[model samples]
Target: MQPRKAATADVPELIRLRAVALESLGTNPGPADAPWRRIARHWFDERINRRDDCVCLVVGGGPGEPLLACGMAWITYHLPDSRRPDGRRGYLDGIVTDTPAHGRGHARRIVDELVGWLHGAGIHYIQLHTSEAGKPVYEAAGFVPGRYPGMDLITAPPGP
Candidate 1:
């Protein structure tokens, strides 16, 4: 199936698919959490509609059909580096596929599309953190283990 750039109208489905992805990663809120749903929807809306630096892509059965997979990238600028003289990097986020749609190459296709788009946009560096199940897919797409180690400091925990 062909991957398409997501529209603002696709936010609801994208949010749902994101939950599926997060759940697979063991990081999602309980399914009945209304507040989290509202917050996620709002966040996605702003990113999809208001942000020029974000791009969301999806592959699926088409309009009125369930999306098979979805992926997103956030563009950021940094001081020029040897690999990226322009200092443009694409941070991949929220790449997920419907549970029932796994093993169909949907996630791979969307990632390929995103990488191509990033290249066309003159972005040379791309990065993402993937689950163990997802490691193979990203690896096959030409991503190597990063040279620099990554560390995170969580300043605060989420509320219940």
Candidate 2:
């Protein structure tokens, strides 16, 4: 499968693939509410079209075809550090492969492409949060446990 950078026209499919990824993680956003879909579509549309720091990649399928896998990366600038002298880091997310398309190395291909692109763009640090099922794949891809401890601050509950 050939992995390519996603374009604006692929927003809808990217959203669908994101939901599929969420489903695999037990957070499937089923078609129960139109508002959520609308919100997500709008968010994705804007991000896909207007964001220079965000990028989405997909493998397999083309126009009018279902994507076999999809992944995204958001570039962030952090304080300069020894490991990341330029401070540009890549945060990978929404990596998913269609159920029937598993075991075909689609996710790996997408990750590889993303890593190459980020390296070419001078991003040396990359990170991702993966599910148990995805740990092996990521480990095999040369991602070891991170050196720095991670923490999160929940500023608000998940409702709008």
Candidate 3:
């Protein structure tokens, strides 16, 4: 399936796919009006098309149809170091598809496209976080578990 580059108008569907991903990871994305949803919609609208720094891709969503699957990534930089040289890295943020679309290759197709885009951008170091069910797709695209596991520290959101 041909995945389309997500546009501002695709934000809602992208949000829907994010909720799907969160649920698949066994976490609630909260209500539709959750603050994070609002924050994400605004971010996607402004950031999706930048191409230089980020990308979001989706399958389906033609006319009135819902999105079949979606995936996103963003690039980040760290100061040049011996370990990473230029220190540019691509983070494959997330990939999620509607339940009915499972067993199809849509997710892997999106991953392949993202990887191609990253490689074309001269990013050799790519990383991703995926559930056990999604590992095969990423592995097929050449991602292996990192020697360093990831950790996150939740912090209070800043007041507006």
Candidate 4:
């Protein structure tokens, strides 16, 4: 049970773990050919690697081998009106856990480490959204459901 930061070279394994995460949600949107898969891979490669706020933790299968579990978090800090910038109320996003490692608390452990880091950095809040399957782990970690429902707005470019 090792927990460590994921490197850029780990992109392929991260993609595979993401496939497992999506399938666990039920419904195969088809193999990595799905548009969402491409988008996710791109996001992981471009966004996570470049952004200081993003972190991806991975667990290797053995001493030095294939990756088996992974978790990601994007830490955002909303600045207050007075502060110049960087003053933040941390928010964690895009978290995923590999399928075979699900019941072993790997996800919870990963999240625990992330939240600890945030708090240590003086972050006031650390929040993440979860699916029904992940609810138990979050709850066990003392996470309570948010009072208001969350929403998202999707946009698309003009079609050809």
lDDT of candidate 3 over 41-90, digit per residue (tens): 88788778555689889999988889999988778898988867898888
Ranking by TM-score: 3, 1, 2, 4
Each candidate's lDDT (Cα)?
0.85, 0.82, 0.87, 0.72
Question: What is residue 12's positional error in candidate 3, in angstroms?
Answer: 0.8
- lDDT (10s digit) by residue, model 4, range 53-98: 7677777755456776777666665656563256575666545666
Number of clashes in every candidate structure? 0, 0, 0, 0
Pairwise TM-score winner, candidates 3 and 4: 3
- Residue 137's lDDT in candidate 2: 80
> Highest lDDT among the candidates is held by which one?
3
Candidate 1: residue pairs that collide: none
Per-residue lDDT, model 1, residue 133, is 94
TM-score of 3: 0.90
Local error of candidate 3 at residue 86 (angstroms)? 1.8
Listed per candidate, the RMSD to the true structure in angstroms reads: 2.3, 2.3, 2.0, 3.1
- What value of lDDT does candidate 3 attain over all alpha carbons? 0.87
Q: After superposition, how far is residue 65 of candidate 3 from its true place, in Å?
A: 0.6
Which residue window of length 10 is worst by lDDT in model 3?
43-52
